[model samples]
Target: MDTAPKRILLIDMDDILRRTLAEQLSAQDGLRPFPVASGEEALAHLAMHGADAALLDATLAAQGLIPALRAGGLSGPLLLLLPVGMGVPIGGDDHLTKPIRLGTLLTRLKALLNQTDTQSASAGMDDILSLGPYRFLPAAKRLETLDGTRIRLTEKETQILNHLCRRGGTAPREDILDGVWGYGAGINTHTLETHIYRLRRKLAAGQPLVMRIEGGYRLATAPVPA
Candidate 1:
């Protein structure tokens, strides 16, 4: 049986680029690209049907669409496509500067998806991990609120939560980085902190579920019902 292809959201204003990339992605097995011309349309589509990953144009990054997408419930890994000499750093999981080779793009996309796939498989069954008023299913990369709203989690977010859950609701910073990112001790990067901030914004709302400890972070053990 053929499994469904991974869905990739492609947002680019350039018609030629969008069509060309979409065709290239479609030609590859196990991949599907849904192209959109504007951030508004992309946001709408994401709200209704989320994708596995998103490829956004640099113009959208300039317009600060990354935060908007996160606020609008896009929890996938985002990759920004930049034109030559676009030096501004974008808030995304990754970025590629044009002129990009299709093979390079495919390799990057597959790496991102494979990372998530490995973690998801290791997450085991769709068991719910409760944190305060939120319930998270690591395998599904999903979180459910007490009010019944469902929020999807980015792959990294899910991995972080799973790591904390396995460590009795609290874990050291170094341990988290090593477990979730496969980074060696003493590796320095703000990426983990950034993802934590975004996850708190999405999952916590007014009530915080993740708390900072002396040398790490902790998840609330008792369920704080809404």
Candidate 2:
């Protein structure tokens, strides 16, 4: 018997579009796509229930809907399923013009979950990121405390942590916004701080892993707990 697919959240209004996308993603290894109709319910689950990634329709009529959802703390790579005559959003990680092609959707979705790492979507960016005294395994989405407790992190939390780690102690606000959040411009890293707070709380302060600094934030070498 095969194992269950990784949980994914699909936020789209159209029933047909939702089902079709879910079916295609279901075929991938360790990839499960959960379907939701409205933006509210979709975001609610993301904050409370959690998802590996999110797919949103650019045509959502609710004003300020995308930004609102993001402000509510969306850290995962977001793909805007574009609408007729509408271009992609400035802050969205990626986008695709829609005609409901399965192959293309899978390719895009895979890329969203896996960034820059070309081998396999499951091959997370983890091995590449190191913050404080810990090396983050992005592929596994797990953070190992200095004391050796392996704490699982959500996709966005991992992404935020990766940006901090990749900084090598000089994490620039602009770079973090563009690199981690996928915004090429309008770089605001205060959002990054919010995420770091939650992560620090989970990992604990005495751990001495993450910290703030001038000119943005920096991930420094931290000592493991004694």
Off by over 4 Å in 2: 1-5, 116-226
For candidate 1, give the lDDT: 0.77
Predicted structure 1: clash tally: 0
> Model 1, which residues run further than 4 Å from truth?
88-90, 124-226
Task: Write model 2 residue lDDT over 1-226, tens digit each, in one string.
Answer: 3254546778888899999888878877878888889888877887786765678877772345667666676656677788767854544545677775777677666655655332223333636455556766766667776677787665556666656654555676667656655455564334466666666777774465666777566655732222
Q: Write the per-residue lDDT of candidate 1 for residues 6-26, one digit (tens) a residue.
A: 889999998999999999999
Q: What's model 2's lDDT at 26?
A: 81
Tell me, by lDDT, which candidate is best.
1
Error of 1 at 128 (Å): 12
Candidate 1: Cα lDDT at 82 = 90
- Candidate 2's TM-score reads 0.50
Q: Report the Cα lDDT for residue 113, model 1.
A: 72
